[model samples]
Target: MLTHAERKRGIAWGLMSLFGITLFVGAPIIALLSWDMETAQTRLFTAYTWRILRFTLWQAALSTALSVAFAIPVALALARRPRFPGRLWIIRLMALPMGLPVLIGALGLIGIWGRQGIVNSLLLKLGLDQPVSIYGLSGILLAHVFFNLPLAARLLLAALERLPAEYWLLSASLGMKPLSVFRFIEWPAAWRVIPGVAGLIFMLCATSFTLVLVLGGGPAATTLEVAIYQSLRFDFDPPRAIALAFLQIAVTALILIVIASFPAPDDTGSTAGRITRRFDGRTFSALFWDALVILLATTFLILPLASIVTAGFKASLWGLVTSTAFLHAARTSFAIALAAGLLTILTSLAIVAAREAIADMKRPGRAARGFSVLLSGTSYLVLLVPPVVLGTGWFLMLRPLGDVTRFAPALVAVINTLMALPFVMRVLTPAIETHRKRAGRLSASLGISGLSRLWRIDLPVLAKPLLTAFSFAMALSLGDLGAVALFGSNELTTLPWLVYSRLSSYRTNDADGLALILGVICLGLAILGTAGQREASRG
Candidate 1:
């Protein structure tokens, strides 16, 4: 019953997903095949690789546990209060770390926790000779917690927020104790999200490159991703690099598989800023604890960003805006980010469209479930293969051709596209699914098919989500320092690279200024992406 164009669209989407598979999976395979077995073997048994492997698992575990443990209390505090000062902004604050650049967050954390940072400075003023060091496992853990805590908290809070209002009413009518209420109500909702959230955090921490590289001081604290980079760039050992990459690929793939087994928690239910009435906490002690939790969490999140603004403002303008290097890097960053954004959104839509087509071609139960799993799995494969692994694979494949730097833009854009796919899809899929469910039959019945259907129907209805997805993807691409680190050169410099470069050269003021500018641009895009929009009417 499908039109010719509809069938074609389905095929096109299927091809796109296949293309994703080839790019992510096939590229790495190509790299592995090209590996020098002698060199790889020599490095494989080294104590360093094993150390890195152990540390990678260790840091990731610690980060996931800490992020989830701290997040539960914060989520509960926010959920139970229902109405509190600055509640809306606090909710919005959780979204910042997701879109914020890792480099920027690192900068913020350093300004707060680094040797010269505010905390250590305060410690020194208190007459302590020992300084706080962020150059080891400690820094890696702190930064991971800073980034992942808000994400975990938001997931738990959303799950709590999505609970039926009647649950609270029943709890109230039954006069359930606080412990009983949480056991029967809030715990169940939050538990559903924890496994997937923890898995994701583990994957993120394991694949962490920029943060680990910047904060990791040296070999003593290296993770597998960082080890891979060190092997390639510092040691110039291709075999070691590929060996470490192989390990990283295995680790991330296993985590991604685990994450996929858990059903994705639904986030489509919006509370619309409406606070659900609660009767569990009216005691003075409860109020004090909630206040303390919210305050400490907010302060931890805000200070680094605040320092960026303050230090950036004090920076000499002559060194930043007027510099030709900074200007060129800014242009290059914007161009790459836009390209990555377009690709991420387009690829996501294609994957979802392919699934929709399959739905039309088959019956609704097990078949639909299979397609759902397939398409969802496809969207997440990118997360399985980290950017450095993907980029390194492409680098090896292209190195035989000509100068790899010539293809840097293309490679970096592709890597960013893959890296952002999971997030962008998470943002856009629900809207697309909602649109199709509400209007698909109607549009098909009206003979609205093909380009006409897309132009007249899909575009108008999905405008906001599409735009939001584009902005979010752009922000993430704009901020990423992953593949670019491997491929970056004098010819291709991004704002993140430039900032890192300045920081490396001891130009702290310049680094601060660039970080601020980059932070502002990212923050602007993130705000645009996360801004709430009313759903488009079927009319």
Candidate 2:
């Protein structure tokens, strides 16, 4: 039933996909295995390492619980409340934190609650003798909530949106009170997503290096990632670093196993059940609660961004623009991001094509089947191997590559593409499935295959998702600081690295300017990539 050309295309695609997936999953293990730890003391089973393991797990669990708990009611309110004039924009703006660099987001948090920050400024204005110290657990937890609340809201909102219109209509017909409607309709739908979203956020928080490193203030707030970096880069303790890296991996694997055991909530049904938009105008109590939630969420989201913009302008704009380091860093960041974006898109396409081919086979033989299984299993490796650990491996391996600094661009590109593959795969998987469902028969009947089928049928159907995936990958690549940190030299600095360096040196004003610029650049690229594909598909 298949031709030679189709088989060749599939093979090529599969090979490329294998490479992309392998780079992510294999790189980390390779790094871990290569780690040269010179010590019985440095072994992974050390008591000190075990103590950190316990603390990391504890924080991640608590943070995940708090993030999900806060997100539930907020997500419900947004879904059920009347769509005011700016609701769509409000929702879109809420997603900004996801796009923002972690360091920048942390900085924004600092600007609000730091010792000399706006909240403290206000407290002083109110005649308080001292500002609240926001440097330990309070800072870490608050920052985690700020970054994750919108994301959790988005995940839960999506679930709420999927409720069938029939559910809403029935609720209305029954004259269900708001609480009753929530109990009967929204909660059931949203509760399912809680575990997955919470787990994901927890994982992110746990793996977080820059956030904890910066906001953590000292030893009291140190996370496993920070500890690893401190051991490797600062303390120069390879045995401790390796042991810590393993500890992080073990903890992550355990958590992931727990998360995987819980089924992911359904994401499809309806964008919103056909409920009539009702404003709670008649009930003062309902109105007060609604306004309070909105106000609190909005303030938490907006004030930090506002502070960044405000600080950026207040800083010597002329000096910031004129700084050679700033310009060089920006150029380096853009160049690497572009290279990474292109590589990621190509690799992701190959992966998609390969997956489609195997899945298309009438009956894959054991050899073909084995390859498919290997490819499918690759994504999990990414979750297992943290970026810092991989970066450490590459740093060790590339010692002989000559001018590791010059190779920084290529190394960064590789790491960025790797970091972005999971997100790209997520975006493309559904789109690919939809395209196959819609065009599988038509293409097969028409005898179309390979590039011809892709160009004529799949491309049109996949344009939007492809663009979304590309944009997401690009944005992620631009914001990454992990691999770049290990690879960066005098000439190979990136905007994120520059931001980090500035923050490390306490050049807060310069960091703010660079952050604003970086955020805008990433946002613009994402918008352009996504919008361009959407328009093309429409045309």
Q: How accurate is candidate 1 locally (lDDT)?
A: 0.83
Candidate 1 residue-wise lDDT, 401-431, digit = tens? 9888999997888788887888788778888
TM-score of each candidate?
A: 0.92, 0.90
Task: Report model 1's TM-score to 2 decimal places.
Answer: 0.92
lDDT (C-alpha, whole model) for all candidates: 0.83, 0.76
Return model 2's CA RMSD, one decimal.
2.9
The sequence of per-residue lDDT tens digits that candidate 2 reaches over residues 1-539 is: 24656666877877977875676556656755666655624577776676667667776777778888888777776776646677777787788888887877887888888888989999999999655766777788888888888988888988887766777667767788887877777778877788788888888888877777777778767888878887867776767877787777787788788878776755443463355454323477776776678778888899988877777777776787678998898788878777877787787677666666777788878887788777666655656777777766666566557766766688778777877877777788777877778777777788897778778887877877877887777788788887687666678888888888988888888888888777777878778767866676799
Q: Which segments of candidate 2 are over 4 A away from where they belong?
A: 19-28, 34-42, 168-179, 266-282, 400-406, 436-464, 533-539
